[model samples]
Target: MFSLFGLTVVPAAAAGGDFAPPGCFGERYGTLFGQGVSVNCFPGEGYGYRVIAHCANGNAFWFVVGEFVPYGFGPAVAECSGALLVPARVVAYEVDEI
Candidate 1:
């Protein structure tokens, strides 16, 4: 669990399975942009992964394997767009084995 602005945020991987942060996996997957949100990436059932963006304003964005990145197995950097009042957090997941 992580904390931001005194709010405790639980990563989506807690519900799915074991997931490592982008840096932990050591590969550049892609980039994410948002505000006031938390992003959680997890391994899916098979040869893919899931990205969940939790927004403060009750908005959620789900990213699949080839949507934002080429393969979906590496590290990613999250950048805030600075357009929305509430920024969202974007997390990229990486797995050692496909």
Candidate 2:
């Protein structure tokens, strides 16, 4: 699905590629639930990478791919930038609207 701001590059199930981080190093990219969901990200230092998540409820949740932080609340929108790319990784992202 194509989002107004971001594009849905990969499916929620995730693709078999280098996008998947070896492990959640806190400094490297990691998953939100790390079990059922495909939400991925890395730890944030000066800033967090903003991303759009496709939830099972058909609602899109705004997520930050930095700070090794757990997901926060609500459906949020964020700016698209190259900085959002996980450190030492190259994974495609898929973004969409509610």
Candidate 3:
């Protein structure tokens, strides 16, 4: 478990095999409610990483990862709206050549 912006970020159990090349890591966010939720990976660290948002609605989205901004909201890797009850998991990974 990790802490980001006072929010507890919990990572799922590591899958077997090496997550080589693109070093991927993930954090699971609980069900989205109200105005939805915005979460960022690797806060305050400038590292090239791609973000994959897996929604409980069986839909996934991708975001271009970029630099981090202090005292400001970073790019949201995942977002939900309307009456869609979706829990999300944000994965941050570096795309490396094989």
TM-score of each: 0.27, 0.18, 0.27
TM-score sort, best first: 3, 1, 2
| Best TM-score among the predictions, by candidate number | 3
TM-score attained by model 1: 0.27
- Whole-structure CA lDDT of model 2: 0.30
Extract clashing residue pairs from model 1: 27-75, 35-86, 35-87, 35-88, 36-87, 36-88, 37-87, 37-88, 37-89
Worst 10 residues of 3 by lDDT: 16-25
What C-alpha RMSD separates each model from the true structure? Answer: 9.2, 14.3, 13.2
Angstrom error of the Cα, residue 52, model 1: value is 8.5
lDDT of 2 by residue, 10-96 (tens): 445555222334322111233332212233344433333333322221232333332223333222232222222331122333322
Model 2 per-residue lDDT at 67: 22
Output the worst ten-in-a-row residue range by lDDT, candidate 2: 80-89
Model 1: which ten-residue window has the lowest total lDDT?
23-32
lDDT of 1 at 73: 50
Across 27-92, the per-residue lDDT of candidate 3 in tens digits comes to 334444412223343433353333333323346544434233232345333343324455333343
Stretches off by above 4 angstroms in model 3 are 1-22, 34-47, 56-76, 82-98
